[model samples]
Target: MNFFQFFVWGSWLISLGGYMGNQLGFSGLQIGSVYSTMGIASVFMPGLLGIVADRWVNAERVFALAHFIAAGALIAAAGMTDFASFYTYMLVHSLFYMPTLALSNSVCYNVLTRRNFDVVKTFPPIRVWGTVGFIVAMWAVDLLGWTKSANQLYLAAGAGLFLGCYAFTVPPSPPYLDETRKKSLMSSLGLDAFVLFRKKNIALFFVFSLLLGAALQITNAFGGPFLDDFKTKYPDSFGVKHPNLLLSISQISETLFILLIPFFLTRFGIRNVILFSIVAWVLRFALFGLGNPDDRLYLLILSMIIYGMAFDFFNISGSLYVEKMAEPTIRSSAQGLFMIMTNGFGAIIGSYGSGWVVDHFTDSGGVRDWPNIWFTFAGYALALAVLFLLVFRDRRIEDIKR
Candidate 1:
């Protein structure tokens, strides 16, 4: 279930930018606008549908239905030639697809708990397969020469269809009809979690989450196309020839770094964990600015490797911090708020903002200044880190009043 769940996303997530820009000649803003669909959908879909799964429908069934709809949307998107049509189809797909990520977890947890497995211990091993699936999909697409073609979408659609059918066979997970708590669209939007803003530390943490979230999208939106550009300069280079495979290293690094998060959080405290993550972000972009497909390829590799630290530290650590700080009654809502700040608002900022940055650096002849663009991103991250260091204060969770 986990494997095919991510298999659907891995088939297209990293390579779509390359396809849109290289094959369809989309401008950076247009491409970014399209990628932002995930963010736009993410803002409301997951929470809204989660309410349905919790109160009205079986989660597995909802999960299955979402995948089936997303599959059709992917098929529609694959046939689109213009940005408007492609964006519309992809937006429809994102609306149904983004929520399934949470639904899959819900289903897994429900089944695992019913079978008497220790969720904390058993779920990680099972979940790691999702990353493995993602890496495998990246390699598959790269090797099949589908990176710049619409075929990746077709592949994803096939996977989505299969997963949708398979979801029904999972353990029966009925809605919790006894859940008496009122769940509304506004609460689902994380507006209830806005009360956390009264606390200075939590407020500051979320503000930085928004900023760093912006940094996360810069690489994802452009990294593949950046490597693809190298074909003009070093057609025979491995990075140029297999950008997806090279990019897969970041996912591989993610799996490794997630294992190390426990030690890092215990040793350094959450503040320093976040600091390390911000510093790593600075390197992630700077290394990209300095590296290439040839002599400086090592820099690119190093960047990919550090991505594990840059991404996992803040995201996992931030979630853990939120869990520790929020009262038990509001814990789930707190997590939802964290996702909203990062993936929702932050994604919108990152997608549109990075697209503008990319266009600003590109010449009228349509040649992008890749290094300068990366350097500019690095500078943005650096500023965030500096401001964060000055404004945020760390307090022990035990010391804070609930």
Candidate 2:
């Protein structure tokens, strides 16, 4: 279930920018607008669907239905030629697809907890397979020469249909609402999870999450396009010929880092783990700024390698922290809140902000100043890292374990 859930995403998430820019000739803001659909959807869908799963419907059923609908949207998106039509289809697709992220985690946690498994220890291994599935999908797209083509959307649609069918076979996870108990309006509407903001620690964590989340989409929205830009600059370069494959190194590194989460979280605790993630983000962007495809190929590979740490340390570790802190009844809602901060608002900022930077650096000749744009992004990440270290209080691992 987790495998194909992410496989569908991987089919296009990393390469879509290149596809739109190189093939369809989308402008920076237009591409960012398209990617921002994920942000807009994340802001509402996860919390809304979580409410249904918690109070009304089975989570597995909701997950399946979302994917089934998303499959049709992907098929529609594949046929779109104009930006407006493509954006509309992608927006619909994202609305249905984003919630499934939290839903999948909720389903896995429920199943694992029901079986008396330790989530901190068990969930990382299971989630690693999702990264593996993502890597496989990336390779498939690149190897088949579909990286800049609509065929990638078709591939995603196929995966979505498969997962939609497979979700029904997963362990049943029904609503956990206690019908006899009187519920407040907030609880009934699933907004009760917002109460966590009243706690100083949780509030600070979420604020930092929003900051970090802004960094998340910068790479995904532009990395492939950045690499593909080399095609024109160095037409004979390996990076240009296989930009998708080159970018797959990031996912490959992600798989390794996902496995290390149990060790990192247990040893360093969430505060330090997240701090390390911020530092890694600094390196990730700086490397991109400094490196090129042919002569500085090692730097590009290094950037890809660091992406694993930057992404896994903050995202997966933060999810685990939320799992530890949230009550069982509202666990899904808490996850939705986390997604809202990171992927929702944060992604929106990163998408629009980075798009503006790209446009700002482009000359009248249509060529972009890639190095300066990357440096600007790196500077943004560095500022966040410094602010996070100064403002957030660190919690010890032993204390959290209790």
Candidate 3:
């Protein structure tokens, strides 16, 4: 299940930019529409599903159903020959897929608690292996030459099919059928988590979450194609020839740095670690703005290296902070709320906003005005960093009363 959750993402994710731009003959905005489709699902499904899992159904069953739907959606997506059709199927697919990211966690938590496992101590080490699984899936596509082809969709579909069936066999997450059960499914879903927006710190965190998310796909949606373009502009370019392999470096770095997240959050605390993330994000975009496949290889490599710190620092550490801070009754709900902010709303902002900016700058030749676009992104990160420092006070937990 851990493998498929990321494996499905890997298929379309890393290579979609090149496929959309070069093969489907799309402009950047059109490609953005496809990417934006994910935001639509992330918003609705996660909370709704979490509520269902908490109240009426088993989290594992919900996870299986979601994967089944996602598999069918992905397979349908495979048959799409045009952007609009592809986007529609992807939209449906993500509605199911996004929730599973959270549901899988729910299932893991339920099983761990039932078995008396020390989740805080044991889960992180086991979870680190999921990053390994993600890296392996990424390399599978690269080595199999699935990087440039539509077959990547099928690779994901196959995994989804397998997991969908396997989900039922896993340990059951019987619905909250206990004496503690409260209001019907509606309230259990923590639809009330939305009230959290009224809180100053949460509201601030979510605002920055969206702005930072804008940077998330700026690279994923453009990086591979950008490197591959050098292949054409410089036919002798070795970088383009091996772009997938080079891009894989980011995942390798991603896997390694994620292991350091628990430590970073514990030692430096949330504010400084998050500040590090913002600084790293600025450099990430700046490096890509200047990097090339040829002699500037080190810059590209450095960009991928920082991707570890930039992405894992903000996302992983942010989630841990929520886990540490929220009241236990609504603790998991708080994490769900975070996803709605980052993956759901933030994704929508990133996908559409970045596309518009990219479209605004590009010429008739389809060449990206990369430096301007990237610097513009850097400014966004910097602005968010400033806002975070000014407004969100992270008082030492013990000093603040409930």
Compared with the true structure, all predictions reach lDDT values of 0.82, 0.90, 0.75
Give the clash total for candidate 3.
1
Tell me, by TM-score, which candidate is best.
Answer: 2
RMSD for each model, in Å, please?
Answer: 3.1, 1.1, 2.5
lDDT of 3 by residue, 194-265 (tens): 666676776777777766776777788878777877776776766676666677788778777777876765
Model 1 per-residue lDDT at 130: 80
* Ranking according to TM-score, highest score first: 2, 3, 1
The digit string of per-residue lDDT tens for model 2 on 53-146 reads 8777899999999999999999999999899999999999999999999999999999999999999889999998888889889889999999
The segments of candidate 3 whose C-alpha lies over 4 angstroms from its true place after superposition are 117-120, 178-181, 184-190, 195-199, 327-332, 395-402
lDDT (Cα) of model 3: 0.75
Listed in order, each prediction's TM-score against the native is 0.89, 0.98, 0.92
Candidate order by lDDT, highest to lowest?
Answer: 2, 1, 3
| Tens digits of lDDT, candidate 1, 1-402 | 989998898899899999999899999999899888888877777766766676567888989999999999999999999989999999999999988876776677678767987544455557767878888898999999999989999999999999999998999877654333355554444354567888888888988988888877777789988998888899999998999999999989988877776666666667777889999999999999999989999999999999989987887667657655664334334555676678767888999999999999999998889999999989988998888788776745332222
Give the 10-residue window scoring lowest on summed lDDT in candidate 1: 393-402
